[model samples]
Target: MPLGRGYLALAALATTGGLAACGREQQTYCADQNGVVVPDVRCDDGSPGYYYYTGSYGRGRRPGYRLGGGSRIASTDSNGRARAGLPSTGHVSNGHVTSGGFGSSGHGSSGG
Candidate 1:
């Protein structure tokens, strides 16, 4: 039996919906205690961080910030090692801005 147009449309919709849920990218947002924005990857270790999206894979969009004195922030420490519980700072190394810190594995969440 030939499928009705309405049935076909519904089937197509269902398939699309199912496929949408299959391939998704989980998004994580990282922020400091004072609510400053940081790189999402910095929060992967479960430091002071928050979830912009906690569910299955999906398109993630995050806010952008304009650095007042350029995008790079000088590291307070000379060795390039950041304090465990501190937020990721833009450390200048070799004339480039690199993310600083080995994010803490402690349990804490901060809103951005």
Candidate 2:
């Protein structure tokens, strides 16, 4: 026996909705060239060092974010990308971008 078209549609809808549950309300934030959280003004002057960011959905910054669309407004780039050298919005350093940690080289958690 084969599944009905209705069942397939229902399954697809459920899967879409399931992924939507893991989202967060996106808000505008100022960030530097590396995507580090900076004062909101940095993005206002249309300068090079700053850009707009939605803080990556599903990261949970605040509340009341609709499913699907992550941000109300995207960054000011033609391709909708902030820049190539920007930081990863997943970790969310909260303006505390650190470089070169134990995870970088072959270093162990317990010091020798």
Using TM-score as the measure, the top candidate is 2
Clashing pairs in model 1? 24-57, 25-58
For each candidate, give its TM-score against the true structure. Answer: 0.32, 0.35
Q: Rate the local accuracy (lDDT) of all candidates.
A: 0.33, 0.39
Clash totals for all candidate models: 2, 0
Task: Give a tens-digit lDDT track for model 2, residues 1-112.
Answer: 9999999999999988766644423344445544455655444444565554443333432222232321212234423322222332322232222222222222111110
Best by lDDT: 2
Q: State the TM-score for model 1.
A: 0.32
lDDT of 1 by residue, 1-112 (tens): 9999999999999988877654433222333333344565544444433222221112332334312211111223212123222234442112122222222222232232
Pairs in clash, predicted candidate 2: none
Q: How accurate is candidate 2 locally (lDDT)?
A: 0.39
